[model samples]
Every structure is written in C-alpha cells, then in structure tokens.
Target: MSDPELATRLGAMIRDVPGYPQPGVVFKDITPLLADHDGFTAVVQALADAGRDDAGRPVVDKVVGMEARGFILAAPVALALGAGFVPVRKAGKLPRETHAVGYALEYGEATLEIHQDAIAPGERVLVVDDVLATGGTLAATRQLVAACGGTVVAAAVLMELAFLPGREAAGDLPLTALLVVDGA
Candidate 1:
C-alpha cells in the first residue's frame, strides 16, 4: 500500500475504461490527476522522495523512465531529485548506440532500449513509472541498467496493481508506490 492520504486524493481522479486496448482489462486512467495542479505536484514530490537516502541525500545519479507514459512522471522526478533523466525507449526510437532487453508481456514479448552511455558505471539510479502491472517493464529497465553498469537504487511508481504479483516480479528491488489497487 502507498500513502493512504495520497492514495485517497489521487485514486478517485483515476477514471476506469473497461476493455481498453484489449478485453477483460479495466484500464486505470490517470490523466485527470495529472490535470489537477496540486495533486500532480504532490505525486511528483512524493516520488522524488523515494530517491533520497536515509540521511536525506539525493543518492541517485540518474532516473530511468520507461517509454511513453513513464516519461511524464520520470522527467519531473529526476529534476526533483537533482538527477539526470534517462529514457528506456521502445525499439528503434533511440538515435545512437543502445543496449536493449526483451521481456515477456502478459500477451507476448516486447523489447526496450536505452542509450549505452546513459548511466556511468557505479552511478546509482531510480526507476519511475506511472503504473506497476506485471513488472515486465521495470524488470527490463533493471536489466538495461545492469548492462549499462548502473545500480538501480530503487523504483518509484505512482500506482501499483497489487493483485498482479508485480512485487514478486520485481524481486528484491525497493519499490514505493503512491497508490495501490487491491484488484490490480
């Protein structure tokens, strides 16, 4: 579970669209929460907080965000944490030499890419995303970070689908979500 107050404030704004992109799936849309200035700010700040150490230092050198929606929250989180933002894009979206990882999605397999030089060796990283579903995306991002020699210090997500076993999928990685759905 995430922060109860934060979840209460932001969860209600998430709209439900049944059978979106496929059947039998209830998509949780968060555009409404993003539109609310205060809500958005709170969410971003709370996510950035996850990048800090116990001594209140920004221990992360980079914030890695997955493709598409993940980019939205991650860029802001990187800025808030005083770290650089790196994008794990899909397929050929990147323009330079990159490292790629293929992971299993619920329906099939997909690939994600990151720049080879995105993170230096020994640099600490924080992965951010809007949602944590099956954890395939975050796991792929973690592999990319390892390939780049960067350490994934933690992962921060706006919402988590708890029922989906995403936590188990992420293994030992530290995860902090702002909202959690039991049905997820």
Candidate 2:
C-alpha cells in the first residue's frame, strides 16, 4: 500500500482509551495493530526504511529501542537495517554496567539505562520506538547512546504526538514517524 493508505490502516487499528493510566489522558493503544501480521510487518518495514542512506543502503551500526513497546518494534528494524539491536530499558533492568539518564515527565522524573558496552565509540545508531509523546524517553535514549560513544543518526517511531513537543525535546536528532497525530 502507499504511504497514505499505510497511515490510514495503521491509524484505524489504534484504539483510543480515554483517561487510561491517568484521568483526562487518551492512550493510543497499539495492541490491535500488533495482532495483525500485515499491519505489524508494514510498521516494521516503514520504520526500517528510516535507517537507510540516500542510496538505499543501511547506514546504522545499531538500532536502540526504548523499553517495553519500543523493544517490540525495534528488533526487526535492526535486522532490516543489518544492524545490531540494543535495548534501552528502565533503571536496574540490565544486569551489566549501564549508562543511565534521568528525564522529567509531566508529573515526575524517570530514568532509562543502556548497557555501557552496547555501542562502540563513534558507531552510527538509529533509535526506534512505538511512539513519541513528550520525548523524555527518546531524549534519554539519545543520552544513553552518546554515553556509549555512539552517534545518533536518527530516531524512528510508529507515530508521534503533534500536540506535544517531542521534536524540540529531541534536540537536533532527526525523527521520522509513520504518523503524526494530535494528542493521543
């Protein structure tokens, strides 16, 4: 399918739950899309293309997926890009030495950690996730990649919240999303 059709299909699969984890917040749930093989593959392929160079060759050395849902989306993207997959998880989840970064949330603070040895110095990395909301998680993931001495080439996501400041929060890092929706 074309990009517009792909976006439409993906959007159709997302179910909105009002006031989910907290009141007055609508969570865009992706469980429905995850269950459909075709939908899932399309997302992976679309995201994987973000790591390619101008000539259509893979340019990333590693693909870092931010915890939880991110892990699910990024692994296959890494394979498609011919890069290694790394996980940026919540603090204390990794057993080995890690580089952690703390970021602010709408209400509080949180930390994300990545294995210290995950990336070699100067390696080009592409960070991937299921969604880009406030961008705190993504920025923290960028920090973790830098701490490991890797250069973040770009950030990819299934979707991004246009109402939030995710792009600004991510600084100069290029971010590509399959869909950009207002709010949740």
Candidate 3:
C-alpha cells in the first residue's frame, strides 16, 4: 500500500486514552496497532520508506533507535534498509565506550548514550522513535549521532504531538510522522 493509505489505516488502529499517566494528558496509545500484524508491517514499511536513501543501494549505514520503544520498529527498518542497528539508551545502559548527549524534556532532563564504535565517521544514520513529543529525545539522539561522527539523514516517528515544539527543536532535519495529533 501507499504511504498515505497505510498511514491512514494505522492511525485508525490507534487508541486514544484521556488522562493517561497524568491528568489532562491524552495519550495516543499504539498497542492496538502494534498487536495487529498487518498494521505493524505497514507502519514499519512506511517508516523504512521514509528514510530510504536515494542511491541504488540503501543510503543509510546505520539506524539508531532510542531506548525501549524505539527498538520495536527500528530493528526491522535497519534490516529493510540493509544497515546496522544502533541503540541510544539512557545513561549507564551501554557497557561499552560511549558518547553521550544531554537534553531537557517536558518532565525533566535526561541523557542518552550510544556506543563509541557504533558508527564510523561520515556514516549516514536514521533515527527512529514511536512518538515525537517535545523532541528532546530526538534532538539529543541527533547530537549523539554527530558526536560519533555519523550524519543524521532523517528521523521518522509513528505519531507527532503537533502542539509541542518538536519540529522546531528538530531544526532543519527531515522529520516525518505518520499521524499528527493537534493538541496532544
């Protein structure tokens, strides 16, 4: 299916839960979509397509996924693109020599780290995540990629909280979201 069509179907499968994890915060829960085989495949394929390199071969040398949720989709994307997969985790999660980047979130400040040898200089990278809230995580991930001498080719997410300043925080990088929530 086309990206738009797949995105529309995927969006329909997501459930919205009001006052989740906190009062006044309506969470866009994707469990329903993730549980469906077809939906999950479509979502992953859309993300992979979004980050595809223009060259005859896959352009990205690596795909960097944020800790936890990012792993679910990123691994498949990396395989689809024929690129290596790297994990950007919270501090102390990686045991190897690492490079770290710090950033502030809506709730608190945090640090993310990637292995020093995850990507070589001038390698192309694509960062993947489930959602773009404040963009802190992704911005920090981008910085981590740069510190490792890798170039961020693009960022793709399943959902985007448009009310947040995520796009502004991401700067000039390519950001694509399958579904956008106006006030989430």
Candidate 1 residue lDDT tens string, 35-81: 99988999998999899988878989999999888899999999998
Pairs that clash in candidate 3: none
Tens digits of lDDT, candidate 2, 1-184: 7788999998899988988778877788999999999999999988988899888899899999987999999999999888999999888899999898999764458889998999999999999998788889888888888899999999999988888888888887778889889754
RMSD (Cα, Å) of model 1: 1.7
The better-scoring model by lDDT among 1 and 3 is: 1
**Considering TM-score, which of the candidate structures 2 and 3 is the better prediction for this target?**
2
Model 2 CA lDDT for position 165:
86
Clashes of each: 0, 0, 0
Q: How accurate is candidate 3 locally (lDDT)?
A: 0.87
RMSD of 2: 1.2
lDDT (CA) for every model shown? 0.90, 0.89, 0.87
